[model samples]
Every structure is written in C-alpha cells, then in structure tokens.
Target: MPNFPNIILFAIPFFILAMLVELFVTAKQHIKSYEMKDSFSSLTMGLGNVLLGFVSKALVLWAFLYVYDHFRLATIPIIWWSFVLIFFADDISYYWFHRVSHTCRLFWASHVVHHSSKHYNLSTALRQTWSGSFYSFIFWIWMPLLGFHPAMIMLQMSISLLYQFWIHTETIDKMPKWFEAIMNTPSHHRVHHGSNPLYLDRNHAGILIIWDKIFGTFQLELKDEKVVYGLVKNINTFNPIKIAFIEWIYLFKDVLTGKKSIKNRILYLIKPPGWSHDGTGKISNDLRNEWLIKKKTYDTK
Candidate 1:
C-alpha cells in the first residue's frame, strides 16, 4: 500500500481544484455568500485536520502492528472483504462518533471548528476539526480488534472521507428521492450545517443517511426555509488557537466553578453545546425565543 502521506499529497491538489471549479460555476447564482474570514479559517482548519489524521494513522498503526506481532497475529493477510465491512462499520462508527462529538464537551471542542463556518460551500467542507483525532481513534480501534487489517482500515476510512467531501457543497440542491433517502447528499449535509431550530444536529451520517433516519435524527429541507448557518452564539473570533480551545477552557471553568453535584458536573461535560449550570447560556431559552420570534416575523412577512 502507498504511504498515507503520499495519498494525501495526491488528493489535496485534486480536491482543491474541484472545489475551485465548483465555486466558479456557482458564483453567478447567488446561492450563498462566501465569508472571507470563515473561508480562511476553514482552510487552516483543513490543514490542521490533515496533520492530525497523519499523526493518528501513525499511532493507530503502531499500536496495531505491535499488538499483532506480540500476539502472533501479524501473519494474517489483508482480506478484501474487510474493505466491504469497513465501509459499513466505518459509517456506523462515524455516526456514533459524530453524535458524541456534538453531545460531549471535550469532543465538541474539536468538532465545533467544522460547524463554526457561517457559509455552506466546498470550502466549508474543508473546514474540519484540528483535534478530532483525540477522540475519533476510539471509534476505529474496533476495526483492528475485529480482525480487519490495519492497512485496510486506514485506506477505507480515507475513501469514506473522500466520498464525504463532495456533499458539503450548496451547488447541488436536491438529488433523487432514493439517493437522498439512503445516502448523505448535499441537501442532507446542508441541513446538518444549518443552525436553524429544525436543523440542529439533524443529519449525523458519515457515508449513509440511513443511520440518521433510523435513529430519528433525520430532517428534510423545507421549501422556502432559509438556513442560518453557524452556532447559536457565533465564535466571532478568527484566532485558530482560540477556535480550538475556547470551548474546552470554558468547559473546565464551568466544571470547577459551578455546582458540586457529580451528576450536574458530568452533565456540564456531556450536555449539548452551550448548555450551562443555570440552563441559561447562549443556547438557552433566550436564544430559542429570539429565534422563534424572528421565525414568526419571517413567516408573517
């Protein structure tokens, strides 16, 4: 198998070229506005993500190779079926990982970077988490333990991620019902990026849309409903360091300064983003009320 770095080197240029073509083709339709601030942040975050992925691949492979050698299981040949199984297994793992990333404070710290973009475009897709590897490795460890070769696990995951890149665009509005029903498409992903009340965390599929539909996280795009992208309380800063650590720092501060109850403290760590001690933070009833009022105004107009 080619080195992972080589694969990334080959893919990055092609991906960028494709994104540029999409941007040029769609620029005339006024589909969405590209915020320069968010676009630069997205590019930086994407590079960070690639770095984290490289590090993670090295670590996971080291662990797997050591364990396999120690246990005399290194002789196992790479099974082609592992690739097939990985497609499904990786998606299932990604579903849970994505859901948890949104729900858990520590995980959300990294995942929020991707959601920080206020625009939905190919560039927004490139806006990835710099620290996602910290928790994401937990999901894929099962692949090796289940007897899948480490090399195959890495390859399939890369391909899965590649498949996901195209879905980030707004250029392709809605696909056929069958495709939207089973797979994650641009429409499904647009809903996921939306900060609208109806769309929050609605589509968590990695490769397949079935998980969201089956688990009740699925939502359809309503005609004439415009999506408001970005978090309830936008970060409003461009510092990459702050973008990565601000939520985490806040989480720790809340854990230390707030209630003493173990359950409440744990809840602070595991609750939805912007959840707080008094239940009155940014994502609180206040924001929801404002959103509702604005929505009503839009409806009446």
Candidate 2:
C-alpha cells in the first residue's frame, strides 16, 4: 500500500476551533443551531468513526494495493496534471457513492448516521459512519485500477473530506453566485441535510456541486421552505451507539421478520429506504412527488 501523511489527523484542531466559532456565532445571533446532547452525540460518533477507521482503512488500503498490483491499466505518474485529474475523479466517485448511499438501503444504513442529528451545525459534520469505511471503499476502488496511485487517491479523498467539514455549518450563508453555481457551499449542503420532502436525497455533492446539477438530483434551497435537518423519521435518540447502528438494526429486522419471500428479503437490502413489499412505505421520490402535487394545487387555488 502507498503511504501519505494522514491530513485528517492534522485537521482535528481546526475542526474543534471552527465548531467553537460556529457555536458562539449561533448563540450570539440567536439561531437555534447546536444542542448540548445532540452535539455531544455527534462528537462521540465522530470519535468512534476515527477509532474504527484504523482497522477499516487498513482493509481498504490492502484492497486498493491488491487491485493496483494486478489490474492497473498503466501506472499514472504523480505529477501536477495527475493531481488535477484525481481531484475531479475522486469527487465524481464520491458523488456516485453518496447518491447510491441515499438511494440504496444497504449503503444508507451506514450513511444515515451523519443525517441522524436533528441539529445541523459544525458538530453535525463530525457525525460520521462507523461502518462506512468498511464498505464505502468499493466506490473508490476503481481509481487504483485506473492507474491513479493509492497515495494520490487517499490524499484527494482526505482533501475532499476536509473541504466538506466547513459546509456543515449554518454560520456562513450563501457564497458568491458564481461560486455557488460551481462549488458546494453551506447553502447547498443545508438542502442536502434537510428532511423536507423537496430536499430529501438531493444535493449529494462532495466538493463540486456540478455533479448534482448534471445528474438532475439538484434542488435549490427555497426561500419559503426552511430546511429541517434530520431524517424523515427522526431516530429521537442521543445515544451515539444507537445513532450509529440503529438503521442497520431496523434494516435487518425488517428483512428477517416482516417478509417471507427471498426476493422481498433481498429487496429490503437493495431497495431504497422506506421501500416496502406492499405499497405502503414511501421513499424520497414518492414523498417529493406528493408534496409537489399538493403545492401545485395550493398555488392555483
């Protein structure tokens, strides 16, 4: 496996400092941004993710190396041009991984930990998945096979992660119109975090907002519809352990007990969240369509 300085370790102080600044600003501005128990739960989840990452990352590196050693098309040199390419390459990979995580129940089981918090603040960014590193690497493993060095792929991944931390806060509002058009800003991410029917599963960008716009998953933050941060069905708990693993618990329970058919059981894993064997449960698109129809009717009235 290739070696690179772990950029995330160095960013720890910056993360804490930024959170403190945001906490102070929100309090002074009289914005209800952070909750004591909620922020604490997010911090605890972040700590667990870092701890679990030690083992999970080792496995990821091994897999990347295995593929790179055997199947690489060509050895891409780590020059300036390569870095430029990998930035976009890794980000698009993140776009797809994030999009899939929202649309597939198996991946969502881990990704939901980040959205479990009802409070959207700097601390909310720290609410990462303990299980994601184990399986999420599958999304990025192709980079190595494409001849991008593991070290380059890993560095860009960290850079992308670092860039995203700032966008989690509600402190900074909109960026310049041009910047907002091209890059992911707090405004864009706020919609991503929102549980509103119109906002669910939208804006799955990593660093660039362009992918969402290109892919038709983009939903602008509406002035009238305030973004509500949390799951459509909030977990209603501050326990970090529960917040991290509750979706997995629910997912397996649904598969094991509710349905008897093997196809239905498999669908419970592959299908989006809120998908049901019967025509009862509703996913994000379902809820969004219903809300849009009602809004259209009200507007005409």
Candidate 3:
C-alpha cells in the first residue's frame, strides 16, 4: 500500500483546510459547535495517531502480506471491478471490527480514545486512536487470506478512513434521507459519538450505513431527543496519553486487583466494558433495554 499513512499525510493540509472552512461557516451562521480547548485536544490526538501510525502500520501490512503470500485461497485480481467488490468486503470487515471494538473491552480500551472528546466536529473525526492501529487490523487478516492482496486491502481501508472523515460533524445535520439510508452521514456518525442510552454503540459504520442496519445496531436520530455527545462517564482530561492509554491502565488494574478469581479477573479483558462480577457496570444493551422499558411504561401511564 506504499505506506498509506504517507498517502494520508498528503490529505492533512486539505483536512485542516476543510476544518477551517467548517469552523468559519459555523461561526458565521452563529452556531456553537467548536470549543477551543476541545478542538486543540482533538488535534493533539490526531497528531499522535499519525505519528504512531508510522511505527505500527508496518506490522499490519506485514501480517496481511504474510497471509496473502502463503495462504490465499484464490487470487483476486486488482482491477476496477475488484475495487467495487473489495469496497463492500472491506466495509463489512470494518463493520465487524467496529462492532467488536464496542462490545469487547480488549479492543474498546483502544477504541474509546476516539470517543473521549465531548465535542463532535470536523476535528473530532481526527481524534482517532493511537493504539487502534495495533489490534484492529486483525479483523482484516481474512481479506488477504481470502485472496485479496494486502495492498488492495490497505487501499480499501484507507479509502474507508478517508470517507469517514467528513461525517464527524454537527453542522450538516442530515443528508437526503436516501443518502443517509445507504451511506454513513454526519447524522449517523453523531449518533455513534452519542452517550445517550438509545445511541450508545448504535451506529458503527465505517463508510456505508447499511452494515449497521443489517446487523441490527442502527438507531435513528430522533427530533424529540437531542443527541448528547461523549461517554456516559466522561474523562475530563485533555492529556493525550491519558486519553489514549487510560483505558488500558484501567483494564489492567481491574484484572490485577479487583478481588476476583484468576479466571474472572482475566475475563475482565475479554468481557464487555462495564461488566462486573458484582453486578455494577452495565453494557450498552443493558442500558438501552432499561431505557426502552421506562419509555414504554411512561407512555402507557
């Protein structure tokens, strides 16, 4: 993939320019969207992510190529139609990768950094994961093994990442309903960032929103309930290291000293986030199910 991070580096200037334009337009329209500190923190996270990608991306490429070299089932050719096929294939890989990131605490430790930001804007999209590059690529190993070249897989992954950049915004509320139905829009992404009971882990699409619909993880943005951004328990620090690695630290701490058996302690890493042996922390589905019952009872009352 010719060092895809270097390829994305070319887009950095354009990304900044787009963010500036968004900021300017929102300011002119009298919208209260970007906060100075939060935006700066998001930028720091982006910078860290890009820098970390330089070292970690090679491992992903190496693993994918190794699989393609030895174990490819069928040689998928690189062509125009191949890109179309891989587009959906790659997006399906992304859908499951993103879904697992939400459900499994091991991955969520890295994935949660992206959600640490309280503000959702162009900059928030840049607030990606420093550690995500390490583990998330495991989900795509099957693509290369299925006969897709590592280079092609990397290309599609980068394309999906690029496609997702613009969707992290509050300025463009909803695209045409049809567009929103098929593609991931800012509206869909905003819900992914939301901490609300109904919205938590609801929209995990990378490029196409169809995966979420098919997988039953999709949630519509309701006019009655405005989306509230950030995690239910917000990490109020802007320190990049804390934002990026705090979850890892917490995960280890729980596993090491939570007064549980060795099996349950180890399970802390494998189980869903907020899972507790003592019945304290709640998973996203648990919270959403409770919210639905309450809403139903209130309506009938």
Candidate 4:
C-alpha cells in the first residue's frame, strides 16, 4: 500500500499537466477567467490542507488500524481488483462528504473557498478548501473500518479526486450519453458549480452519477440556459480568510440577529447557502430570473 504522500507526489504532476492542457484549451476558446488572483491565498490554504491531512488522516488511520488489529479481520492482499473496489467506495464516500459539506455550516465554511471563483475552469479545480479535511474525512473513515486498509483508502480517494479534476471544465460541453449517464462529466460538474436555480445543490456525484440519480439530486443542463457560476451573493473580496469564513460569520450573525427559535436558527445553517431569515432575497431565484431574461434577449438576437 502506497503512503498518502507518495500518492500525492504521483498525482500532483498529472494534475498540473492536465490543468495546463485545460488552460490551453480554454484560452483557445476565448473564455474569460482568472487563475492567479489571490494565488498566495490558494497556496496558504493548500498548505493548511496538507497539515490537516497529516493530523486528521493519521488519527483516523490509527483508529482503523486498532479496530482491524483487535478483530483480526483477514488482511486482503493489495491487488488491481482491490484498487477498483477502493476507487468506487472512495467515490461513494466523497458523494456524501460533498453533500454534507454543503449542508453543514461548519463544513461549508471550508468548502466555500472552492466555489469563490465566478469562472469555472481547470484553475478552479485547484481552488481547494483549507479546512475541508477536518469534516470531509469522516465520510471516508468508514472505508477503513469496514476492513479496507488505510493506505488503500487513501489511494482510492486520491484517484477519485484526480478523476474529478477534469470535470471542472466548460471546454468539453458534454460526453457520450452512456459515459455522461454513468460518470461525473464536465456537464454534470458545471451544473454543480452553477448558481442557477435549477442547478443549485444538484449533481453531487463524486465519481459515479448513480448516487445523484438515486438520491434525486440530479439535474440535467438545459442547452437553452447558460450557467452563471459562483455563489448567489458573490464574495467579491479577494481575501482568502473572508472567502473561507464569510459564510460561517454570516451564519453566526444571522443566528444572533434573528428572533427565530433554535430550530429555525439551525435551519439557517443547514439550509441552502442563500436561504435568508425573512425570505426576502433568494439568490437562486434572482439568478433564475436573470438567466431567463438573458435567454429571452438571445432568442430575439
């Protein structure tokens, strides 16, 4: 079983190369985007993630090892087949992790960094969360406890994450029907990143599309409607600190200001990102209206 560091070392180069290819393609298509604004923030957040992975993943692996040692579960030899199973299992775990990350205030604080970019490109893929490893790892710990080795779990997670990187692009409009139906493709991911009403919280598949379909969170991209990327109330600031913690701060502020009961306060945190106390301004609806009006004008053109 390869260590997490080794897996990262092998994957980072591939990721970089793939991102470069995506950038070249995006440039050729004349897409307007930003890859380097607040780069230091991305670097710092990435460094923080490395540290968190070391501490949290180590502890989780230790706990899993303890359980495995105590139960004396038959140690399966690492093989190609095990890798395939681990890949699928890791993806399944990620689907839940991502869904919860959006739904939970504590997790959303970390997850919001990735969505801060209004432009969806390969660079957006590198705009990762600094604090996501904390809550996100819980979803995958079950894999190791269920008898898969910690190293195998980590490898599968790495591969699954690597596979998702390509799906962050707008360059590839869609894939073959069967591939798009089974796997998370660029079209599916674009919807996930879109702020459009129909796209909100949709297509949360990690590797397989089945989870989103089964859970009824799946949404197809409408050709007539263009995607407006980023959050409802866009975080205009470039500060990574604000980008990461803004929602958490806002959630706390909402709880403090509102006369709502504890249940409602809790709901504010767990509800979709733009759900307001008075229901005055819904980002999803505003975006939907904006999209509809734009579509109307384009049709006239």
Candidate 5:
C-alpha cells in the first residue's frame, strides 16, 4: 500500500477548493460564522501539521512496521473485506483517541488546538493539531499487531479524516434522520464542536455513529438549544503557536504551582481537563452534571 502522505496528497487540493467554495457560499448566503484571521490561522495550522507530519509520520510508520513484522497475529491481505474490517477497527480507534484526548489533560493539550477557533466552518476542519500526531497514533498501534498492514491502517485513517472535513460547517444543518442516525453528519459534528455544557465531550465518533450510540457518548442536537462552538472559556487569540501549546502550558503551570500535592499534580495530567485539586476546575462530566441539575430545577419550577 502507498504511504499515507502519498494517499492524502491527492486530497489537499480538494480540501482547499472545498474551503474556497464554503467561503463563497458563506459570503453569498450571509453566514457570519467565519472570520478572516481565524481562517488564516486555521490554514497555517493545517500547513504546519502537514509539514510536521512529513517528519513525524516516518517515526510512527517505523513503530507500526516493527510491530507488524514481528508480532502480527496473521497476515491481513488487501482484500475488499479487509477494508470493511479496517473501517470499523479504525473508527473505533478514532473514537477512543478522541474521547481520551478530551478526557486526559496530557492529550487534550494537543487536541485543544483544533478546538481553539470559535468559528464553525469548513476551515475549522483545517485546524489540525501540531502535537496530536505525536501521541494520537498510539490509539491505533494495536491494529498493526492485530494483523492489519500499517499502510492499510494509514490509508483508512486518512479516508476517515477526509470524511470528517466537510462535517465541520454550519452550511448544512440536519440530514435525514436515518442518515444522521447511521453516520456522523454536520449536525452530529456540530454537537461535537459545541461548548455548551450539555454537548461537552459528546458525539466522539468517526466515519460511523454506531460507536457513539453504543458507547453512550452520542447526543442529539436540541431544537431549543443552539450550539456554541469552541471551548467553554475561549482562547481569544489567533496565534497558531499559542493555540497549539496553551493547554500544555496551563497543564504544566497547574502541576508546578497550582498549590497541589505531587500526587495530585500527576493525577491532573491523567484526569480530565478542568480537573483541579482545589475544587476550582470543572471537567466535562462535572459541567454536564451541573447542567442537568439546573435543567431539572428549571423543569420542576
């Protein structure tokens, strides 16, 4: 199989063209979800990701190949059924990687870059993480060991990512219920980007929605509640470097000087973002639980 870079190079032009079309449509339709500085920052982030990937992917590929050559259970051939099998396997891998990224402060430090932008548009999809490629691929290391070829896994992973590109938008609202039920549509993805308490850390599926449904991370978009894109506390800056590493900086700062014990400092890295030893931070579930209590009180009243 061809390398992931070679396979994904074919999609870069299409990604650019699609962004242009989204920009055109936004202008024509009076959509105000996009901003110039934000879009440029996103593009730069994407370019940085690709440039960094050219080097980092080599290390990741070496690790995958080493496992594939030595410990693979069986030789998985490049057959049609193999693609089908990999689709589910890779999607599940992505679901867990995404979930873990949101939960662990260490991983969230990298993933927070993608969510740094407040805009919900095609360009937001281009807001890839510079540091995510370092640890995110750990989620799929088992695939090569389970007999899937490294190239095959890389190819399917790229396809999954390409499929996700278009869903990061405000143009298409809702799809057919059946389609939305089965696939990750714009509506589903919008919920994922939402900073709303109810939507935080929900809808973490890739390519297919079944994993989210089965795993209880799925949340439907409510007709009465609008989705607020970006983090609960917005970063409020356009610097790509800051956007990429601000979370890491904050994590280290908390661990070093947040008045926490050494054990708690370590736990802060493993615990969800927004966790604090002094009872100040709020994790996603904490936020969701607060929302539920408020909602229940409002309903009762």
Candidate 6:
C-alpha cells in the first residue's frame, strides 16, 4: 500500500495551458475547434468527474486492496521493470474496458458522456465521464489479484490517461511512421472520436495503437472522408447535467417503457447501443458493412 501521488491532479495546470495554446493555434488556422458553450460544458463535466472521484476512488482502492490482501498470486516489488509490465497490462485492460463500453449499453451509458460533445479539441479531452469511475475500475481489478501493487497499477493507469489527453486534439496530424505504427497518435484517436460509420467503435487504444491493429478494430483516418466528431445521434445540447446523464435516461426509458417481453427488456440493458431486439437497429458493424458495400458497388461501377 505505497503512497502514489495524484498524477492527474499535478497535471491540471499543463492541461489548461495546453488547451489555451490549442485554442489560440486553431483560431490562427481558422479551425472552429472550440465553441464557448461546448467547451464550458466539457470543463464542468471534468470538474464533476474530479469531485466524484473522491467517493469513487475510495471504493476502487478498497477493491484493489481487498484483492491484493486476499488473493494476490505473488507480491510484485515496485521496481522499474514492474512499471513497464504494468504499463502494458493496464493498457490492454483499458482496451477491453473501452471496447466493452462501446459495444454494451450498460457501460456505454456512462461512456457516452465523453462522446456527447460534437467538437474535438483539447477541451474534448476534459469531457470525461462523471460516472465511469464507479464501475470501470472493475476492469483493472484483476491486476491487483495478479500481484501488481495497487499503487503501481493506479500510477500506470494515470500515465495512460495523461498520454491519451494529447491525442484528443486536431492540432497535430500524423506522427512519424514508426511512432504512428506503435503509438496512439492524434490521427488514430480522431477516428475513435468520429461519428463516421467506419470509425465507430474502432481504435480502442490507450498508449499503444498495436492492440487495435492486432485485434482487428483498427480504422485508419481517411484523408478523403474527414472525421465528424460526436455520437451517431448527437444530443445537441451544452447543458452539463444533460450531457452527463442523458444516455442513462435514454437507456432506462427504452428498458422500462418498451412493450417488448422481459427477455427483450433485459437485452435493452445488455445489448450494444443501437441494438433493437426486432433487428431494426443498426450497430457499428452494421453501419460499417453498409458503407463497405456501397463503396464496393461504387468502385465496381
């Protein structure tokens, strides 16, 4: 139970400075990167997330400590190599957690807050989920049981979070070829934020892009088709409270008011977003396939 300094807290000044710089640069390039209302909403959500973390983090720490105390396979020392191992372990865990969040309605209810903003900029990085911390930590609980110290696991998680923040902007385009191939850059992450059919549910990387490449979830950002940020059906509001909880409201409304059977109601909760029991709703794969087919037909013509 070693003490780990709150890396994210220490980085707040850097976050603000980076966003200010991005605001100035994007304006210079005539890019409408930040709308005042949207950016303000994002900042508010980030503040709420930080405040909620006080309660949620305690539960997460308790869970990790419980696993470490009762079930750890071996005690991993806090050596330099342990940091490297945890970096990968925590990242892969993040990949799955993020992937599941996109595919499953329950998790997506919380994660949708991040995608609610229609604009992609450094501020969008601050558009975090206020509720994700409560249950998302479950994805990392296995690390503690695997004998990695809780403090080390948490530190690596923060590092991954920090690494991801910069990739949220449009200021930097592609990185060097080798770096782009291995790491998640702005180009890769732009696709993740896009509402475009081909980009949906793709590139669920933390620090490395290799996981998406290996898992067949990678979609390169297309020069011809520019990335359109936000959800497939945009909420179109800047109200922070609405942005934070709208998806959950929609999810429960569907589950509770539908005339479908109990099984279908359960499916509403567990199935992917845009999943309808009647086979009418289109998920990411459905949209991507339709796009691919249309592209193929056009190419042939």
The local lDDT score (0 to 100) that residue 270 gets in candidate 5 is 93
lDDT of predicted model 1: 0.77
lDDT, candidate 5, 67-102, per-residue tens: 999999989898899999999999999999999999
Query: Per-residue lDDT for 81-143 in model 1, tens only?
Result: 655767898889889888888767778877888888778788887887766765577877766
Residue pairs in collision within model 3: none
Tens digit of per-residue lDDT, candidate 2, span 1-301: 4567999999999999998998889999999998899999999999999999889888988898889999999999988999999999999999999999999999999999999989899899999999988999999999999999888888899999999999998888889999999999999999999999999999999999999999999989989999999999999999988998899999999899954699999999999999998879999999999999999999999
lDDT by residue for model 3 over 1-301, one digit each (tens)?
Answer: 4343445788899899999999998999887789998898889999998888877887888999899889989998887898899999999999999999999899999999989988888998889898889888988988988989888888788888888999987789889989999999998888889999999988899989999999899989888888898998998998888998899999999989847998889789889888987888899889989999999999999
Q: How high a TM-score does candidate 5 get? A: 0.96
Which pairs clash inside model 1? none
Task: List the global CA lDDT of all models.
Answer: 0.77, 0.93, 0.89, 0.75, 0.89, 0.93
What TM-score does candidate 1 reach?
0.86
Q: Model 2 Cα displacement at 93 (Å)?
A: 0.2
Tell me each candidate's TM-score: 0.86, 0.98, 0.96, 0.82, 0.96, 0.98
Better of 5 and 6 by TM-score: 6
Clashes (candidate 3): 0
Clashing residue pairs in candidate 6 are none
Better of 1 and 4 by lDDT: 1
Model 5 lDDT, full chain set: 0.89
For model 1, state the Cα shift of residue 173 in Å: 0.8
Which candidate do you rate higher for lDDT, 2 or 5?
A: 2
lDDT of 5 at 1: 54
